[model samples]
Target: METKVIINEERCKSCSLCVSVCPKNVLRISNRLNPKGYHPAELFNNDECISCGFCYLICPDAAIVEVRRPIKVKS
Candidate 1:
């Protein structure tokens, strides 16, 4: 089983709040800039996300949105 996370780059403020709040260190700020010219956050590995919701709740700008991906059943 694995988890996934998606980040909205334009909404991110690069405040590093998400980075610090992520106990799993799933979120990180990159040197890469968004179209809006602001540094943004990226997932270390989408599948590595634990869906802890720390990043989403801690974001001051409400930039981080967490989506959980449940493992599919193999019939």
Candidate 2:
């Protein structure tokens, strides 16, 4: 199974809660600022992400979402 992390940049409040709770260290504060003048969180290392949902759960602004793609079954 593969997992993808999607960040709603506009909604992010630049809080590090998501980054700190992420076990995989997949999230980081971006250098660029959002429209709200906040350094939104970004996915830095998606390959290492286990999709534990810690980041999503910890985000206060509902900025992060994890999507788990179904693994393909070979006949």
Candidate 3:
């Protein structure tokens, strides 16, 4: 499966809004801190993500760079 969300760690401000808004609960605050001394959000389970873009919309810092919907190929 392809990744649904792309997070820019440098731009993240350790906000939990994304985590709270994620319907699948795939996003989480990493234990590791970024260069700005903030715990950036990371994707824990890409397979579970529904590509709803909730995380992207809720992000105040615009850390989430991309939210992609899976391409369906007709057989």
Note the clash tally of each candidate. Answer: 0, 0, 0
**Candidate 2, residues 22-58: lDDT per residue as tens digits?**
8777888999999999999998877787777888888
Candidate 1 ranges beyond 4 A from true positions: 1-3, 72-75
Give RMSD (Å) of candidate 1 vs. truth.
2.6
Q: Judged by lDDT, which candidate is best? A: 3
Off by over 4 Å in 3: none
Of the two candidates 2 and 3, the one with more favorable TM-score, higher being better, is 3
Better of 2 and 3 by lDDT: 3
Q: Model 1, 1-75: lDDT tens per residue?
A: 434666788888788988898878877888899988889988876666778887878887766766676766899
Question: What's the C-alpha lDDT at position 74 in model 3?
Answer: 100
Candidate 3: tens digits of C-alpha lDDT, residues 1-75: 768899999999997999998888899999999999999999999999999999989898989999998898999
Clashing pairs in 2: none
TM-score-based ranking: 3, 2, 1
Show pairs that collide, candidate 1: none
TM-scores of the models, in the order given: 0.77, 0.84, 0.93
Give the TM-score (vs. native) of candidate 3: 0.93
